[model samples]
Target: ITDWKLQKEGGAWNHCSSSVNHGYLRAVIIALYKKGFTGKDIAASKIASKSTIYRIIKNFKESGSIVVKKASGRPRKSSKRQDRLLKLIQLRDRGTTSTELAQEWQQAGVRASARTLRRRLLEDGLVSRRAAKKPLFSRKNIRDRLIFCKRYRDWTAEDWGKVIFSDESPFRLFGASGKKLVRRRQGGRYHQSCVMPTVKHPETIHVWGCFSTKGMGSLTILPKNTAMNKDGTNTSSESNFSQPSRNSLVTNNAFSSMMEHLAIRQN
Candidate 1:
């Protein structure tokens, strides 16, 4: 009789006239009853009303636990295993719409509606979010970036200062369009699975610029669809910054050569 504890089983509460005691308070009530305290004594002890105490004792005697019986209702439509399977399917493709999910779930023998699917996902900590926009990277781009990092991982601050970084970027004359939705948990906004990859839009213009510890380099506008070589040659300008110098460390790219030249001249 000493083992009564708060039950973790999920169930609807039967409507009752009095607020039910739970946890330690319920434990104390049962303890007093086991100690031969009368229902009147338990009530007079200010624990619960006489009827409530008597009901508790009756329930405890008849049922091994004092947990209030749930009000009878229709059972859950899906089993725990089905719910888990639904979660797995949703995670397999975060972009799947709830309607699409419902169709897939029906194939798996769980005929839940889109609303029900959303409810189940919410219970499992998955919510729909507008996917974060990330620049699409090719395998070659990723490999080159990794190589670049490893090559310069040990470079000092001064070494970096002597290097000018430049890159060309496209800006859409209009604006970025549309959004995609993905299911994700909290704090996973930038997860690869939760991102929408994008490339340069068609109706856009490209601009190339360079900067270094010395100062900002000249801003140069390039023709639409102009190819930018790694050596920074095809889109060269008459500006002094674009002229390659012998002090170039990494590339003949205008920025590197100019920054290195400036560094040498200053020294």
Candidate 2:
């Protein structure tokens, strides 16, 4: 304990990043070296390790200074132009996986590791993530959608406000179709935000609902195995709407399973 205190007071061994601190410690070690303190003796004092002390002395003898020289680290395998080419190749085919990108990069005369490729792409702000899913429309579907938009383009918000858009969406009774991520506070296990809400087997049913710009309408669950059509449950749903919204529109027309606007009326 007394020896350690003396060494610490003289110049303690500390983990330092700055060269100045290392240089000061090197000076202290050199001073001790001059006073005939052998490497084993300095190691015993625990001021610094025997290997570090020897290295510092060797450096001082060679450089004529207490400051240790810094060695250059491992060189980068890819050049700037090669990295830019890699980004271009990556952007050319976004769906290409890292493994596939490595192959492609190899074909272009650049042999880069998968980790190296990822690091380069990260530098370019291009990160790998799951591609979002979207419904692909046929030419006719596109034309129909465009026509529908054009037809309603002239209508004012008040004209559209009277409308109620209705649709039937089926939900899984057992569990969610896909996992949903929720941000939760600590110790909020029983809180509403942390709850994984799901309809139990009995309460689960196919619901038909109405939506409007003003507000929402009543929600009614359909009975099992009933084919919904314009003349069936959908027409009956008009009465179930609690709001005095006189207008009505049933998109995604049930008859054809196409986006067809129907029964849009203002009373």
Q: Candidate 2: which pairs clash? A: none
Predictions: Cα RMSD each: 12.9, 9.2
Please write out the lDDT profile of model 1 over residues 1-267, one tens digit for every residue.
Answer: 222222212132223223452544566678878899777777765544578778888888999686778888977768999999999999999999999999998998988789989999999999999887644557765555556556666889877776656666777655355667789999999998988766675566778776667677777777766745665533342252544342542443434434444443466
Q: Relative to the true structure, how large is the alpha-carbon lDDT of every model?
A: 0.67, 0.70
- Backbone clash pairs for candidate 1 read none
Scored by TM-score, the top model is: 2
Q: Candidate 2, after superposition: displacement of residue 226 in Å?
A: 5.2
Overall local distance difference test of candidate 1: 0.67
lDDT of 1 at 221: 76
Please report, as a residue range, the 10-residue window in candidate 2 with the lowest summed lDDT.
Answer: 258-267
RMSD after Cα superposition, model 2: 9.2
